[model samples]
Target: MANYVFGVDIGGTTVKIGLFTTQGEMVEKWEITTRTDEGGKYILSDIAASVEDKLAEKRIEKSDVAGVGMGVPGPVKADGTVIKCVNLGWGIFNVEEELSKLLALPVKAGNDANMAALGEMWQGGGKGHKDIVMVTLGTGVGGGIILDGKMLAGTNGAGGEIGHICVNDDETEVCGCGNKGCLEQYTSATGIVRMAKIILNTTDKPSKLRQIQYISAKEIFDAAKEGDELAATLVENHGKVLGKALAQIACVVDPEIFVIGGGVSRAGDILIDTTAKYFAQYAFHACRQTKFALATLGNDAGMYGGACSILNQ
Candidate 1:
């Protein structure tokens, strides 16, 4: 086995790569635009070349490398074919076979959120806990589940898609998946911003938020920190929706802990404090034992997750 493993997170906008020691320390990391519009052929070629260049720079031979793992933004078949990638403009990609041929190393591929969960399980907030759930609050929400010390990817590989779980029957805004009332409609970063806009437009109340043309969820979070009642209420609204959805999920899975991660999670206690309160109100009494915490691995969790996926094999 090689002395180091390589991890790659294939996000919608960028590809993050990291070289990691067996002990899970990241030695070096970098990123490149995904540019998936160029076709899967060029994408794989570029990845292969980049790996080759990195190996040469470090004077590491292929024989000294342990393995490679990749986290892609879509479902992957057990045999490594991508079922489809909505963001990458590709379908049925033979990721493992093609990349292994070019790089002369074993490659493991999995759903990006699942890999992130694995990373948290191995090194972040979920460390030392076998059964865990990771919720990433990004442009959208992504969830991953680990049960009985194993990552659960249901048949057809679409499990843990918690964002689409319907929470508000009265909500009308359709999700990208063509569904209305999904949890993301109220819980995602974009959803929070939409709520902020509604508050600004509907109320005559004076507020600092009106000065900005396009407000982001982060701005709302910042405003809440400064004791803005409207911003605080917006966050509370988001928490209630997310909590209702998570309560439903918790009833079924019963994970030991829930780790919240991603950029929006940086809202810290403002988000967590509200979420914990709402989650308790919404969840069944039996599920009250499940602890909630922020993810410790931060942005590198995706790359670490990719590496952990390889370790699993």
Candidate 2:
């Protein structure tokens, strides 16, 4: 009988693999280096070998496994085709079919961000809520939307590209997506540092942030926590933009909760508190009271989400 499932989260540097019961309890997890060489020719074969070794080590029969669910770092078609993943040196291809053929098992795939949100909804911050939007703030911002317990992987797989939402039409600098004034340009970790530099250069504000040679989003939050005036301003500005964008998202999805994750979310309550404050200020009346929470699963979220996908399927 099919009693187990495998969850794989593919990243630029590593691939995180997890073994789980059909009930969603993780049994074991491990990682392998991602070989991006030769246009990622070895990635699928490597994963197949690793999965075989793991099943053998666990004495689990191939027939006893339900399937493998993978999370890729790029847009994925509904049929599990990856359009492209520059970081992984990949081009358009059917990841599901290739990996399935290699392993001789069923496979399912989705965008990593969407998988993270699914994980959160299944077992993390958004567990109790069926409708939620997850925003991941790292070097850049990533997002995913879940409605009525299903992921909305829209046409072209760009449903939850919230980071690219144009927030500042006046911005002179273009975003990584080649857009000017994207939400990521102001709310990401790098965006915070960029804003801090502009604040330091444009204004002679007597603040502790001016002392740091290399400023990071964490540093800014730390200084803000200590009551640094300029740092507080920067944090507030970050909150304003982020909260406003979230409010806009709420207008569309009307999710019950907003789960915040990624590296920048390390600021904890301060980030949520400030963003909530601004969200209330700008949100539509009916959605103004929407809840916000921090993602508790961290990096393992993708693994859990991958497993959830197969179980749900």
TM-score of 2: 0.98
The pairs that clash in candidate 1 are 2-64, 2-65
- Candidate 1 at 293: error in angstroms? 1.5
TM-score of each: 0.92, 0.98
Per model, how many backbone clashes are there? Answer: 2, 0
Model 2 pairs in collision: none
Per-residue lDDT of candidate 2, residues 34-120 (tens digit): 999989989989999999999999999999999998989999888888999998999999999999999999998999999999899
Q: Could you tell me how far off, in angstroms, the CA of residue 264 lies in candidate 1 after the best superposition?
A: 1.2
Per residue, candidate 1 scores C-alpha lDDT tens digits across 1-313 of: 6678888988777888999987888999998877777554467777788889999999999888878888888887656778888788878767889889999998988788888888899889999898898899888888888787566777766777888898777877789778888877777888899888888889977767888888998999999889888888888888888777788889999889989997889999888888888889989999987888899887788789888877777
Worst 10 residues of 2 by lDDT: 150-159
